[model samples]
Target: MDKKVTIYDLAKELNVSPATISRALNDHPSISLNTKKRIVSYAQRSGYRINKFAANLSKQKSNTIGVIVPKLNSYFMSSVLSGIEKVANGHNYNLIISQSLESENKEKLNTQTLYDSGVDALMVSLAFGTENYDHFALFRDQKIPLLFFDRVCHLPNCPTITIDNRKAGADATEHLIQNGCKNILHVGGHLKRNVYTDRFTGFKDALNKYGLEYKPSNFIETNLDAAKIEEIIDHLINSKEKFDGIFFANDAMAVACMQSLLKKGYRIPEDIKIIGFNNNPISEIIQPNLSTINYPGYELGVLAGQSIISHLNGNINIESAESILLKHELIARASSSSTN
Candidate 1:
């Protein structure tokens, strides 16, 4: 018997994308006739057989859900995923997860791959560079339930679960302001993302509410990766304003920056009060415990999973679903409060 050949083998031989091969083999109109003919000829010669189980998937409910995240290894994201997995597994549903590595093109590719895999529903946490959302139109067109969590975006009927970031940001800043910090700095990620944008907005709102002046240099936007803590340190050291306090967007960056500042002989909560978001475990482990917002990542994930599953089971209409906002609280720790 001849070995069973797959589309990957065909794509490798034809020097085309797997998507193009799949399209050509399916006689999709978008593929040029020449390309289709070439693919068909090769498939026939090599006895390539499409997986019948996958081919028949649309007719039969696969009981499978797909998820796309910016990155897979974050402490906060892992907690969210744990909640999602617990709910999904309890309901006997399977999850197909992919990471975009924070790239727009990779996110698009993952969307296509998940759609082609016949997922009944899809969940996504947007990538940093995903300005275009057209890749998700197919799911909406096919009446598939789509849900967004954490780093979410607007997608017409798709529901979203997240904290009130603007409020959370404001609270953090106001707390710092109340603690006697006059000149404060916000270390954040790209403003293109809602999480970062909302946090920045909240920070500004707090400053304005307390009659503090806002300067262009007050906000320093970076990739927010921990490895680049030196850049933050440099910005802090080289700046003319001499920031009296700092609010970091995430705990990882906040913790790393705190360590760097301590090593550089800066006093925490005295010289430069600091706080971060997400309440990562490291916040407590550090010498001066990090103050942060309890973002409820795990609860957010459980709610997101349940919401999507509810829509899938016809328990609710996704089109009418409203965005769910989880409550966030300020955790006053040694790093931020002067009293601590």
Candidate 2:
């Protein structure tokens, strides 16, 4: 391999001391602007790379923010990650992202690895089965800024960003009722998760407000797997009281449900109306466009990035801010609208 360019090489080439090169590269105020510019240009042209590990160890700052998510393949989660990368890169920070694959054990391991890697901050969206958050204590004990978005858990001093799930859920159910859907079924994810649980609470609250009877058969909890769509279809087909509407926790499940319903000769919004959360792109692509709550995953990520960076810069006291709730809106489409 060719000889790797180093600070010493650049210093020798520029006829400056190694200390001067180091200071200039770091953008120290003591170095003259002209000298710093020259050093930077030369370093760039020479393909010089700084050993960030050594520098991070010496300065005790990694300039890297760690992010943990349940999965990377989802449209909404990936969009959120893209937004985070945009803000972090603009601010000269790097993101180290890892997936938990909905496994709490893997999530714990990733948390420990991120901490060991000396990430300056941590952002997490909990795994599906992550009931225990003890792995996050290392960061808390060390006083590193930790932020949670979407699938969040309340850890003392950690800032969390999410929409008012209860309100959104209520809105979705109420919309269905307004469109003359009395016998509605809510397909949901794990109830252990606050997002789904809060949504289910809203679902019940709306039913109670409208004086509609809450039936045990009205709520179907699943992992939202597409493969299990047949089971839901079977339930819908065999139900004594036909469900006129459906409210799903996530767009993926809603889309799967819609497809299954269509195959069974149910006309969307004509026979049954449907609404889902997280205005994912698929919501638009489906035959009868799905009406959904616009969850704004990208904006959530940007806000999370800004909040953590602000905390790191000492410009904002994150501890004083307990929860940051983003606005959610109901998007009317062919699936849930009567007149559309």
In the order shown, what is each candidate's alpha-carbon RMSD?
Answer: 11.1, 2.2
Please identify model 2 stretches exceeding 4 Å from their true place.
Answer: 9-17, 32-47
Please, what is the TM-score per model? Answer: 0.83, 0.93
What digit string (tens of lDDT, one per residue) describes model 1 on residues 185-251? Answer: 9998888889999999999999999999999899999999999999989988998988988999999
Please report, as a residue range, the 10-residue window in candidate 1 with the lowest summed lDDT. 52-61
Clashing pairs in 1: none
lDDT (C-alpha) at residue 326 in model 1: 96
Supply the TM-score for candidate 1.
0.83
Q: Give the TM-score of candidate 2.
A: 0.93
| lDDT for residue 55 in candidate 1, whole number 0-100 | 57
Q: What's the lDDT for all of these models?
A: 0.91, 0.91
